[model samples]
Target chain A: MQLRQLSLRPFRNFARIDLEFAEGGAVIVGANGRGKSNILEAICYQSIGKSIRGARDHEAVPHGEGHFDIRGDWQQGQRRHPCRVFYGADDGKRVFLDEAPLPRVSDLVSHFQTVYFAPQDVALVLQFSAQRRRLLDIVLSQADAVYLKALQTYQRLLTQRNHFLRSLGHRGVDPTEREVWDAQLAKPGALLRHHRLLGLVEIMPDFARQYDVFSTGQETAGLLYADEVIESNPDEIPTRDQLEATFRQQLRDGFEKERHAGHTLNGPHRDGFVFTIDGEAADAFGSQGQQKSVLLSWKMAELRLLERRKGQQPLLLLDDVFSELDPIRSAHLIEMVEDFDQVILTAPRQPQESLGDRYARIDLE
Target chain B: MGPEPLEDLVVAFTRLPGIGRKTAQRLALYVLKSPPQEAESLAAAVRAARENIGHCTRCFHLTERGQELCHICRDPRRDTGMICVVEEASDALALERSELMRGTYHVLGGALSPLDGVGPEDLRIAELVERVREEGIREVILAHNASAEGEATAEYIHQRLDGMTQVSRLARGLPAGSDLDLADRTTLAHALQGRVQF
Candidate 1:
């Protein structure tokens, strides 16, 4: 799916902004913090009901405003569609597809499989495992509804469990009450882990191939799920039997401790995704350039996977990421996106004369 | 002018997960107006809780003893042959309200969500299977919510089990799109009692 037009009202620095996209591609050019990222943020908000920068709903409102609104016209498959998202100070946020209210944010992901690249994406390789896991999640969630549902359920349980833990010491709750939460938390948690392991298995080969492209075939990349319960032994990845047994044992052992401490400590929240280059941890050992290349390869693999699965190219949002890379990497990125049906790139300035005339630029002041 | 302590309090509060600036200010003023002893106790409570509580070695549940086993694991009356699986410990408590499940439980910590980058390896799935095998569990009930990830997680477990033992899922009594914990006690109890074979 590709965005054809976007309209924003009191969103970020844009008081009332309307912009249209060409059939092929559009380049948004602006100085730093001149509402360039805001425009992209608006698109992301309408598509996914959240900001790429992790802005809260109220934060998305202009500095002095209490409400923010975004509307987008897009083409998915053979049909043209209009989608809108509105956030208000008094009321909760709402999403509309072709003017009809959606039941959930996951419904929006069904319409548009968007892959965004921000400068922070470089951190995918260098930052904590959560970032890398998020990278995998955004891509896999769009591709599979089951994955989205599992994630939602898992997170909801985690929040509830933590809340219970927080209240345990203060509230007059029974000791047995904690057992109930343990039983409920385990089922989905196990299922979530199963899905992640499968997703990595399915996407790892593709990730490796793309990594080779970005790394000039000098590095071999691999993704591994690292957890005390799942694969404690590097030589023998624990079988499902072993993993489940460990889970039960851990819960059994921790029951009284959970009540005493008022918190659930074990599970996916503590898990990490391990990225390796030639059997070495990437985050600890990879250089800045290598990290960037790893992230680019992962994102490119995401694009290819979505295109293959959806039978349509997704709209690509590149948010001022070009400045972080060298000219060669920038050129490689440009070449990678050349065949996309729609690409929206934000940069400090227009590309040099060498980029030719394939892209249309829009200036934001 | 000196730094505005009130403003700093508001900013700090806003940094929390859900608290906004306005709520933060309300909280700060409440603390400021409270008795000195109360404020000191609150401060002491925060530090004491963080330092005293830690994960149980056996179940990974938070505790103060730093012991290997939790209370439930220590309970001899609970059914050891049956295990109710869930995303977090809170679900275990919600189930306990029904008083229908007599068996023990295993907390996996989360459901499989590939998009959010959560996977089986992130959760406690392997440990769950191990618990089942080592404990001689006769039945494993998959109690994840009825969502895509929940179903996928159940399927993944079913595949891994490979008929080592019977595995079932919580029945579809809860609303099509709803959370299990949010369901009323009656609904949750019924769902658990009516679980179906996976």
Candidate 2:
């Protein structure tokens, strides 16, 4: 999907601006604090229905302003969709596809797809397991609606089950309620584990190929879904029933342990995603550059999966990340990115690498 | 400024569900401009309804004051062996409107939601269990909504009533007259899962 025109009203630092994007998309060059990233954030906010920077809706509204509105026309092949998102202090957020109002914000996710890459995404590999899980979740959620629904259901059940477990620490909570929550949670939990495992399995081959492209194929890279219930066999996908049984058994056996912890101690919520280089853990054995390579490969693999699943090339939003990469990686990244129809890039200044003339350049003061 | 009583009246209107301050003020002004008899009749009707309505002893459904059993429970022709359990009194009424079930109804006050501090003891689960035991119920059809809390409540009740009587839940699928293309993926998936052999 490609954005044709974007108009932001009182959003972030921009009081008002209208951008007409080219077929190759545009690069916004500016000094720091000139809202270059904010433009990317506004574009991403339309796709995901919230700030990718994790800012609240009210925060996007400028100081002394009561509301913000973003309007854009997105093109996918021959069809063009007019999208509008309006947020008010009084009326909350409303999204429209074409001219009709979307009943739910989640409905808008599949309408527009974006793969947002920023400089901080390097933390996906070096930081906590949650970051990797979130990346996997975002990719999978945008690609598959069933996975998104299951994820929402799993999160809700996990919250309720944890709340009930906490109440078990005190009096007046029925012990049998544990069985109720277990039965309720097992289906979605197993589904989440299944999808996460399948996602890694499907993406691992491309992930390794992308890593080889970046690393000169010297060492073999691998992705692992570190799950206790289902064996991570890339050759064979685990059935949801297999996952559900093991999940139920784990919940039963770990009840006492969970009670001691005052919350859930098992299931996919605690599952680990590990990146391995030459059969060794990458975070422990690899250098910082190697970690960033793994992250980049994983993101490219995500983009491929999105394209394969949705049958559309997702809009790639690159935010101030080109300058952070070394010359070799940046050159290779540019080579890979040139194949895409639309690419939105931001930088502190025009990068040394000359992006081809297909990219429309815009400078902000 | 209007008098304190008018402000108090607006406040009272706002106390009701889904009434905002603006809506409350509008209602207060509308009431003020209306005839005196209209306000008196409205007040008398609210007072009479509050005084006359009470819950049935068995099902917890709204019944006339001093009634032991609701009209459904008192009907001799209705099947006493099967009880359709629902999450709310309104749910029971909805199922009754379908005219499909010949059994009596059991209205659980609400579903079990521990996060909201609602437990089995807070709902009418114990009463339903007692009725199933003492009233010779053969089957309890669980008509709870298809929400997590509702499913948990149904499972809990099924556990409690294990081996004593058969328990079942309502079949969920596409709404009547809804086109298959219009069904959301989740609903379509559910309908596929619950599809019957024709």
Candidate 3:
């Protein structure tokens, strides 16, 4: 999907701004604090239906303003879609596609595919498991609708089960109730883990190869799905029935532990993906530059995965990460920019290298 | 603020489901502009309903204050041997609108939602069990909403009544008139899973 035009109102530092994108996407350049990142944020929000920086909806509203509105004209193949997202303090958030309101915010997923890369995303390799889990969720949610629905169901059931456990006072509750909850949870939990492991499996080779290209070949890269419910080898994507059976068994076996902890102790919620370099945990052994390389390679693999699954080039948003990259990684990003259908990147100063004839430059004051 | 009575009316309207502040204000204004007797009648209806309506002795459905049974329970033509269980009286009413079911209903008042502090004790599950055993019901149809909590409630009831009598859940699939394209992906998947022989 390509973002043809974008308009923002009362969004963060930009009270109002409108820009028409070029065929190859535009490079937004401005000094620090000039709202260069806000442009990319607006475009990302229009695609993903929320603040990409993890800010709450109201936080994006300008000072003393009650709401923020983002409008984008997107193109895919021969079809053009006009999308609008409006959030108000009183009415909450609403999204529209072709002038018809979507029933849920999640309905916006996969409609306009985008892959966003920011400096903070390096945390995917060097930070807590939640970041990597979120990366999996974002990529899968954008590539497959069923994955998004299953993910939403799994998260909600996890919360409800946790609350139910807390309400039980940690013991002596009837086992049938737990059985009911386990049966309810295992169905969606299995779907979540099945897709997660499948995604990791599909992206592993690409991830490994891209990491080698981005870094010295002396080290080998590996991705492993760390699951709590079912034990599987790195290459084995278990069937849904096997996953469900194992999930139910784990929940039954972990009842006492979960009851003691006052929450659920097993399921996809507690699962994660482990990135390793040279057969060692990258988060613990890799240097800062190595971690950046890991994240960059993972992102490139994610782009490929999305393209293969979506059958089209997804909009790539690079948020001012060029200065942080070495020449090698920067060269890789520029090559990716050329390969992609649209790329909107924000930088403090324009890179010296050319981005071909179709790329446009926008300077913000 | 406007007049205290008008504000009070708006607040009361706002307490109703799906009524926001703007909708409540509009409803209050409409009530104020209507004839005084119309307002009096609405108030009287609400008061009378609250005062007179009570749970049926056996099924927990709304009935007259002093009545021992609801109209369906009192009807001799209805099949007392079969009972349909539901989460709320409104659901029972929706089922009754079809004019297809000939059995009586047992309203559980609500489903089991431990997150909301609702449990088996909070609902009329024990009473349902008691009626099934004492009344010699042949089949119990679990007609609760198709939600996680509702399914859990059904599971709980099914376990409680295990081996006591035959039990079945309502068939879940696409609506009759809805096109296959109109159904959501989850619903479509469910319909596929629950598909039967042609």
Across all candidates, the chain A TM-score values are: 0.87, 0.93, 0.95
Model 1 agreement with the true structure over A1-365: per-residue lDDT tens digits: 77888999878888998998887768899998798888888887765678766668888887778899999999876888999888889867888898898776666774687878775557643577776777666777777666676677778766666666666555554333344445556666676666666566656677787777677548788766763222222344445455656666777797667757756667765667777777677888888877877777777777887787778887888888778877877887888778888888888887662554656789987
TM-score for chain A, prediction 1 = 0.87
Q: What is the descending TM-score order?
A: 3, 2, 1
Give the whole-model CA lDDT for all candidates, comma-separated.
0.73, 0.85, 0.85
Q: Could you tell me how far off, in angstroms, the CA of residue A281 lies in candidate 2 after the best superposition? A: 4.1
User: Relative to the true interface, what fraction of contacts does candidate 2 keep?
Assistant: 0.68
Poorest lDDT segment (10 consecutive residues) of candidate 1 chain A: A227-236
Which regions of candidate 1 deviate over 4 angstroms?
A163-179, A227-246, A254-261, A353-358, B1-198
TM-scores for the candidates: 0.62, 0.94, 0.96
Task: Kindly state the number of residue pairs that clash in model 2.
Answer: 0
Provide per-model DockQ scores.
Answer: 0.03, 0.74, 0.72
Better of 1 and 2 by TM-score: 2
For candidate 2, the per-residue lDDT at A78 reads 89
Clashing residue pairs, backbone N/CA/C < 3 A, model 2: none
> Compared with the true structure, what per-residue lDDT tens digits does model 2 show for residues A1-365?
79999999979898899988998888899999999989998888788888876678999999989999999899988899999889999989999998899887777887788988885557543577876777788888888888888888888888888888777766654767778999889999999988888888778888888899887449978876773222335658769999899899999999888877878888887888778888777877887778878878887888898899999888998888776677888799889988997999998888888898978988887
Worst 10 residues of 3 chain B by lDDT: B112-121
Sorted into a CAPRI-style docking class, model 3 comes out as: medium
What lDDT tens digits, residue by residue, belong to model 3 across residues A90-201? 9899999988999998899888888888865675535888777888888999989999988877777787788888878844587778788888899999998888888877
Question: What is the C-alpha lDDT profile of model 3 across B100-167, one tens digit per residue?
Answer: 98999999999888778786778998899999999999999999887778878998899989999999
